[model samples]
Target chain A: MNALLNKEMRLSASILSYLFIGFGLMTLLPGYPILCGVFFVTLGLFQSFQSAREANDIVFSALLPVAKHDVVKGKYQFSMLIELSAFLLMALITLLRMTVLADSSVYLQNALMNANPFFLGVALLIFGLFNAVFIGGFFKTAYNFGKPFVSYIIVCFLTICAAEALHHVPGLQALNAFGFDHFALQMLLLLGGALLYAALTWLSYKKACENFEKIDL
Target chain B: MSIVELKDVCKTYPAFRLHDVSFSLESGKITGFIGRNGAGKTTTIKSMLNLIHTDGGEISYFGMPLSGHETEIKQRIGYSTGTVSWYPRKTIRQIVDVTRTFYRSWDEDAYRKYMTLFGLDESKKPMELSEGMKVKFNLLLALSHRAEVLILDEPTSGLDPFSRDELLGLFQTLREHGVTILFSTHITSDLERCADNIIYISQGEIRAECSKADFLKNYGNPGETLEEIFLRLEREAKS
Candidate 1:
């Protein structure tokens, strides 16, 4: 836990120093899925940093006494924590921004619904967490990305559009309407994202470990 | 009992293949795994660490199959390689901080001591260092870890003579403490200065393995001077 926290601190300090406000914006969504999306993007960035540092993160990590899965678990959890923090910060900003809207209580302004903290969070979560992590995991395990920048950008844009489409669905959109005070709903969303991230993390770890054993370092 | 043992371990891929190689390093000694580039030194080390999957045979470390007691065994073992790469922006100190998290017996003070001893700028990025310094830095990192066994693959592959001597001196001190250093190197003189035993590998097989001193005593040369012995043995095995 200390290691995870320490790495987080180190990373957060560096990110903070860089004034990476996009990452900061990513956290602001109120919906759980969007928050998860922002979190996974953050993890993708972190893994990129690791890949830059060590040509092979899996190989170097396997060299440690640490099991492959635990390492992945630690990284995924850290991503979630960062996401949670980002979303909280963003939610506060959105709440402040929401106050600017005239007559929000009667019916949410159509414009605000489009950019609503709650809905935006859901959108980002689906787009960022699910899409980014799967592609990143594929590249990471395969020891190479298909096209790097082109693939990532295309995927990011497509996922954002898909999440936006999903938001218009009457059934799914209602889940995010559990307005301000229903803290339990918010927790559940985050927990669901966490569980999904954890599951993916375990699968990626196993694949990488199996690959590491056969890898000629 | 063998402190590190691998019997007929095989790992295969499209381009790379680690055949059924077998060797063991007994406790309380240095075992030099000498192989040229692509001779499977790193492959063998990776297998010991469970970094790769072996298709055939058993690999026992610290008296247990690798799958049996990985954590307990790995914690007691130190591993390093000549191939060192790092995040271009992270400093040596930051890397050390990252490494400290996994091991139960992380020697922070020793880590700092080695950082200073090597004259490595703890504040500088690993990628910024020269190749020799990079290798040295990695070596120092391995040395500082409070592991009972050291498994170094080409530990001194790119060091200057002075740094090489410094590393040998460090290894000598470690051996005195019964640390059991196992390093693979092509530098025969480096092995002559420190290794108690040698495992000469060729064509995916351990062609020769014996005490450095005894082999030299019988061969009438210091530490099996000629490559012909290994070549001949390899040929004999094939025929």
Candidate 2:
């Protein structure tokens, strides 16, 4: 398991620079936290899909003395680790911009409060669906490179757009108003997102492992 | 007793099929797997290690089913493919660092010895190595873990004579130390020099499996080589 993780870390290390650049750009997207949400969604899912493009890494991992299940599990866990790191970074940046930067004129403080946990929850949901589809697709053919990345981008764009639009829905307006005003409800919403993320990640890992077993390597 | 066994192993694809292939590698012996190109040698090797999932068959190593005991079985077996399937950008040191973590009993001193013997520079990336050097690096990774069985696929396909001779010599040393090896190659002469057991596979089936002396006695004139016998057998199969 340690070997698999180390192998993935080395293989995906090159992509880290892209993730950092994307994260920086997203943070600077003035007043729009949805860009940050999209950034995390894309990076979390791109890590595995990009690694799958390198035949060397898959073949090398297959040759290792680990179970197929462990291979899938390690990759899924690594993706989540990256996603969690991005989430923390975004949270820190938002907290600073809201409190320290004290940019009262910027619209981000208002949007962040109104959306509460919806952005993060939707980000988690988007990545969950991405893994379930992308890993299954990769293991099926074992070598198509571009379609998965394109599919993921489309999914994230559509989901983020929908979540952003929800801020204007009349019926959901009361819910958002309640969420923004009540600290406990906001924490509850975050907890719900965390639970959903945990469940979907586990389900994706299971499906990937099952799909991987049937592959001929 | 056989160290590796394959019984009725089969795998199929759109372009090719491995049909009911069966063979066994004896403990403490060098088994040469011979065939022409596209003759299912790599497929058979992959099936044995479960690198490719067999559609129908059974494989066992050291008396246990390979499917259930893959991890434990693979720990004692070292493998190399025809092409070096490794990260091109990683230096030799980085490759070793990742691979060594998988095996609990990895011998660092033995690994370093092979590194020194092969004159492999730690700073050099895989893309910098010659074909022969890549093969040597694979062998070093295979041998460093104290593996009991070695399965190599076309390990000497295109090498200069000196490197081939050195690799063959290393196989002999490993054999003397009681390590069983099964390596596939089209180079019949390499087998004639070192292999005591011969398994000839052609077109996804086991054409022949026997000891070298028995094969020579049955199929060859006193001075004729295994290559001559192999070509003759292949011709007969086609007809």
What would the per-residue lDDT of candidate 2 be over residues A1-217, giving only the tens digit for each residue? 5667677776644565245534633543545644555455456456555654563666677777887567676667666666676666655554455455544455434553233444455656665656665654565655664676577667767766676667677766533432234556556756776777777777767777777787776
What TM-score does chain A reach in every model? 0.54, 0.79
Residues B165-201 of candidate 1: C-alpha lDDT, one tens digit per residue? 9889988888888888788877767887888888877
Winning candidate number (DockQ)? 2
Best by lDDT: 2
After superposition, candidate 1 runs with Cα above 4 Å error: A8-57, A97-121, A131-136, A139-142, A146-159, A162-217, B213-239
Error of 1 at B18 (Å): 2.3
Q: Please give the range of 10 consecutive residues that has the lowest summed lDDT in model 2 chain B.
A: B81-90
* Poorest lDDT segment (10 consecutive residues) of candidate 1 chain B: B219-228
Model 2 per-residue lDDT tens digits across residues B66-96: 9889899878999976576477777888888
Every candidate's DockQ is 0.39, 0.61
lDDT of each: 0.62, 0.74
- RMSD of candidate 1 to the truth, in angstroms, is 5.0
